[model samples]
Target chain A: MESQQATQVVLASRPATARASLENFRVETTPLPVPGAGQVLLRVDTLSLDPYMRGRMNDARSYAKPAGIGEPMPGESVATVLESHSAEFVPGDVVLAQTGWRSHVAMDAAGLKKLDVDGIEASAYLGVLGMPGFTAWSGLEVIGKPKAGETLVVGAATGPVGSLVGQLAKLAGLRAVGIAGGPKKCAYLIDVLGFDAAIDHRSPNFAQELEAACPNGIDVYFENIGGAVWNAVLPLLNQYARVPVCGLMVQQSGTLQHDTSADYLAATMRAVLTRSLQIRGYINYEFTEQYFDSFLREVGTFLREGKIKHLEDVTVGLENAPQALLNMIDGRNFGKVLVQVRSNASASRS
Target chain B: MESQQATQVVLASRPATARASLENFRVETTPLPVPGAGQVLLRVDTLSLDPYMRGRMNDARSYAKPAGIGEPMPGESVATVLESHSAEFVPGDVVLAQTGWRSHVAMDAAGLKKLDVDGIEASAYLGVLGMPGFTAWSGLEVIGKPKAGETLVVGAATGPVGSLVGQLAKLAGLRAVGIAGGPKKCAYLIDVLGFDAAIDHRSPNFAQELEAACPNGIDVYFENIGGAVWNAVLPLLNQYARVPVCGLMVQQSGTLQHDTSADYLAATMRAVLTRSLQIRGYINYEFTEQYFDSFLREVGTFLREGKIKHLEDVTVGLENAPQALLNMIDGRNFGKVLVQVRSNASASRS
Candidate 1:
């Protein structure tokens, strides 16, 4: 395996703002590592591009460590185990690994989860069956706890996390209101994803539209976009509403000023005192150990039975990863952004 | 009963700022009514003043209805049952009721809670065993989940809710850091109440003092006073910290200017997303049914064993109720603000 070469993207510098240029990344070739005892050597098939990766570029303290300068960009990936010295895994087995922004990686079998893509695609393990899906599931079920006849509002409604969140709410017998940038995505949410209503945040009457859609008031607001959408949703949240803070995609460039957050916080506090609002924040990793089995069972069943549906915005090849990531942060990708490094001939059509 | 006159306070008008004058309240006398079936007529003995009442004075929609003009001030109070037509209670029985700012009230027996003073003072029910105590227990135990070795910070350190919160956190094996208005209260928090450290918010070096106190970073910021105290506590909170939105006492009178509540909210949302914070808002009523028995047992045991010691700022007579309430909101009350309308010989010496 030392003769085989691996392609990797390294963080060249810290980004000052959202206009993160590719000059901050350098693709390098390294000798593919051999599997040590209890470790597996894997060929990466697809790397997941998420909004959280943008935070890693900055030298700020986050839930996870910021990717230091010159380190490989960290991310989750779906890969095939090429060779393994561990009893748990074998060659030709598809698995999920933290191979990060690379075409190949060698890691202990303990950290890598075996992906059972029997009738499902391996890339789905990176999105709906992976972190993004679990984020939606945990935030909604554990935090939001949206009940039947209640309202749930989620921004970036067409993205992997938000789309699944809205769908799950609808399935839970609640009114799902989706907020997306364009009229097309809004239309896609209502027409295809079965959300009760879709509010186009790009529209001049975005706040008004959101107010109109959430007639019963927003009982559960999955706060993923914390900028203008937050301002819009603030007044409409019902008494005792639940706000599960999932992401802050809109504040990537620091465009949204911080002055408005405190009033909302005061109002939210007042609401909590009066209405008993519960706003809890969680990363999927917290629940991974406890809820992994149940999440895989429930969400996996939902996907296989077509009870839940997800769209993909595939960015083909390792070279397009940086651009794909940029697009993801900018809301350019319509769904889960997947960087397809290698493909199986049989699974290509799907 | 129809000939009996009841003195009450009405909302004369709304104030523009924090310096609410006596003109804001109009004192008037109205005829008392007789109790019908399943009802009790009560002579008020004490009224509990809480920060939430400040929100009701404003025209904003909250968990409860705003105080209407020409209506008596709303509050929970301890009273002697003067007359009753229900089998649930008899005349001379002491009980707690939401009788507002008045000398007497006619309430449904079902609406009143029988006050079992047994070995404790009646006013203690309004502070420790009542709403404020429940607020602390429910918010801290259910939301904050203060663990051993973790630090818990709370503002308005000498007040009923905050004082109990600190004591409770200490009992749970967590270090308690308190924030109070002046040096005297800070002294009480440290020397008397046994808080690990107390920062005087009114001091010139408040922010620095707060930062210096919490070496481990605050694991539970039991937020009540949402102003400079929150500003100081925000950046110091550890990852995965819990913030129970209990009150916004700092913003009660609307005198705050150039206040960074918006920035705090944005930061809170970002913290929630990146750090996975659990910021929950709770009303004591929501948790009463579920935890009341356990609270009575726990808090009752603490009080009997002298594990918790508290001070009472007793305002003797109903005539002083208005000023007492105003003082409590202005941080003039050093401890639990209890308006004593009637005397009990067993009252503990202050």
Candidate 2:
């Protein structure tokens, strides 16, 4: 049999601002990598595109290392083991691997987690049953500390993390109020996702709508998108309110250039002092060691029971990843964004 | 028997900025209050002047009601019960009361906490054993979470709260670094208070000195005074650092007029996200229900064993309280500022 060719997208350039464009990525084809001893050759099935990828594009000090120029843009994917040289993984085995924006990868078996997709879809592991889902669960449980009857406010409501956060809050007996960009996302938050109230952040009277949604002030704010959403939520935060900050979607594009007249830092600190507020910033992986298994059990049960719902926006082919990522960052994608790298015949095999 | 008059200091005006002048205060003579049913007539011995009072002076919404125009400025005082109409106290009994800036007061017995001053001085309750001490204890324990061998940094080192915080950190087996305004105060922090290192904020190489002191990077920052000191400490903060923000001394005087052109607010949030930091703001009273008893027992013993030391800048008369408070706010007062409202004749009875 002739050797197969693999397509990979590499970071061509870093965006000067937070706004990323397709021009920043370059798609190239190379020979499929051969599996070495103790390694498995993966055929990428579904690639997860997240907002955090924006931070990795820039050469800045962050939780993770920057995606180097001329290298594949780093990402997690649900892949099928096309060939195996390891005792752990066999051919046709579906697994979770950090395969980046590539069609095929030869990686050590130790790096791949074999997936047991008996009753669940393989792509679900990339969204609701995966990192994004774990983010919502840990941040809410550990930092947000949802108490029954309290109101919870989350931004980017239709996204994987935000939607799951609202559902979890509702299950925990909290009043879940979601803030989304458009009327459609807002409608989905309230009608489909079971949020108590939904406010369109793009509305002219956003602050007023947010206040109306949360009759009682926000007790826990699941902060993902910062900037105007944070500004609106600051005054509405009740005494001893907890804010579990996971992502700042707005600032991920670049450093904010705000009007100089306001001293927002001083005002924020003042609120923290007077209201006894707790603001904790975190990344989900920090809790993986302690809480990952618990997350899988709890959230998996919720998903299996039809208690929590999720949505996905898929772009066909690995070459469309740059556009998919840009769309997700700009809030054009309504849910968890994924790049379908190949047909799921191998992933569906028992 | 001749009726005695009481001299009281009242809030004459609110400061337009953070700078409060003596003109904002007025001294008045009123008839000594007569104890009513379930009441106590107390002669104030030492009045505690704290930083929180500046926030109360503003008419803005906060945790507590703002000080009303022409009302005696709210404060905590250690007093001698000259007469009692309740079963809880009798003549010559020392107590803690919310008697404001008055030399004498008639208050309900429900509000007064009877003190058992054995080896500790009665005035000690107004400083090291009182609100400031509790502020340090509760903020450190509840928010700072100082672990053994971690580095703890505190501002206003010679003040009641900072001094106690450093001492407590040392006791907890953490490296304690203190920041103060002048050479004398910095010297006192290292020599008298047992801080591992002291950095003078007045020095031109303040940030460099702070970086030198905390070789391991700051793990916990007891933030009471916010301004240049906070700016210096921010860059040196380690990942997952905890900041218990009790006060913003510079902002309390007025809005911070910074020389930097960049948006500090955006920078701060970015740091919070990148570093996974925990920033919490609280007042001591918030922890009074839970941690106050633990603080009194632990710190009270530490004082007895000479494990911790305290200093007081006592002004002679009640008339000088306005000046004393101004001095404290301006960083001119060396330690905890207090007003000797009356003779210790009744206090010496214990």
Candidate 3:
């Protein structure tokens, strides 16, 4: 924190295809922004890197608006309130804001969410206690509707959302089977997160392994990466299986080769009709007003008791935020990807 | 009525492909068996030809088991009880039975459901007042969950299930849009069925016309024919759209060429996630124990008051049952396809 200037990463150009590259982002520095009346000057601490950012790079219709060229890539981050012109927050207070990839931002106090920082790190809100955590909770309870005896299969098992989904399903008395890219995440899902079983999606016999892990057939599928993994889950889905489609990481991530065979739709429709499947897609905010309070109460208790465990994959600087996001999209980054702009944990604890 | 023999249409062979042909069924004759203890002799009067029966012909696992080769093709029909061996029923009673394509068969009294036939035709138990009617009701109310001022689109809009779906949507205060083949059925959908708009699926500009029809975007799509029609409905669907996949007529019918371009699934999955869509598949029977009585009460009243109307495409005699089913699957039938095995409207009206 020696410079009087603020650093930010902006969208340099839109990706020509679903796959995004480092060339699409640019880093620049400007004079530190001053807080206006009823606003606070925030110094970014931890920036959340999500796969959804890839969708924002394209000029496609999504729940949120696409990031414009020369505009800071949209994101949520934990920041320290350096200077406040409002009664709600004080200097050195940690708050959450949609300040994108900026090292510092002048934001209205009305939009900032203050953190409790009660034993847990302030950055925990951006991962486990924030949007990713909320997404997993809402999608599982509202759409997936897993029953105690049922089996639930979630993709991206080591990522923030899928990890929470598996742990929650296990807590709800379901047989949780997770699908991850490697043996390490797979082992972590079972050994660390208490998942009943975990299958490496990259295995040559992935489908057979998934089926073997879920001997009772999948009752709920928490869909994040939709591609070969979705196809594998389709046939094994039990009658009236519920699929809560929260993300399509494989679709947005340009690394996976597009399978040209389209009869996949026919097979999907067949399974849907024959097995009476329920596939519902949703975003977290849709359930905020309806279930957020309950979510906070329940997940907060679970977090405090150590019933749920989470992981964070942090990059070191604001300039490298773009690479962190790209890495997350390509599944090269593990856990909840984040960019640590400033590492002063004392600011929140004090 | 003088014959002492029973006639049956058995599955001669399973279709090698999705398209079933007349050769797959064979008509056979056997000596009529006397009613056994606790069984009654049922004379088939009206056999309901449903799209689901086409699924039973192939050796594919569906809601019902695959029809055994050389065994009678499974179906439900309105029948007349000729002899009773139990106190539960007597002769001259109208009943519903799963006797398939048969002129006469002995059924257990426990399985035979005695029909009132108070004002409506006993055949109505096979169409507007029966499974077709119930299918539309349960799918729309339970799964579709349409709200007032919302747009509801249905394929096969002039048939029994689709007609009732559109009428029910109209009655529920929705903008009902129908997708049918040719100008005749399209006109009938708007003029007689009271659909807010009707688009001819046969038109070269079908997608454009459909988009124009649903300016508000589709909220409930009663998916019966899932092919190009489904493709057309995908983009037009609004956020939180509900699709109750009752039948995939196009896939089973095999009249429409399989679109070799397979990007349809990607488009479907993308829309499902971006728009937060809900696509569910179900059979009417799943809701039978829960909502059947309510369905009969509401739809029965609508039928009597003329608030709802239905059409019966009848092919006389038991031998033509094969063609009746084929006609339905191929979209040649104009309305509710039924095989009138006996000309005895007087049996119920008396």
lDDT of 1 by residue, A130-167 (tens): 88899999989888887999999998789889999999
Give per-residue lDDT, candidate 1, residue B264: 64
Record all residue pairs in model 3 with backbone atoms less than 3 Å apart, i.e. clashing: A262-B262
Selected candidate, larger lDDT, 1 vs 3: 3
Candidate 2 clash pair list: A17-A253, A18-A253, A18-A254, B18-B253
Q: Give the chain B TM-score achieved by candidate 1.
A: 0.85
Model 1, residue B25: C-alpha shift (Å): 8.4
Candidate lDDT values, in order: 0.82, 0.88, 0.87
**Model 2 ranges with Cα > 4 A deviation:** A1-44, A51-73, A80-93, A101-107, A254-258, A318-332, A344-350, B1-43, B51-74, B81-93, B100-108, B317-332, B342-350
The total of clashing pairs for model 2 equals 4
lDDT of 2 by residue, B248-269 (tens): 8777544333444666767777
lDDT of 2 at A168: 97
DockQ of 1: 0.50
Ranking by TM-score: 3, 2, 1
TM-score of chain A of 2: 0.89
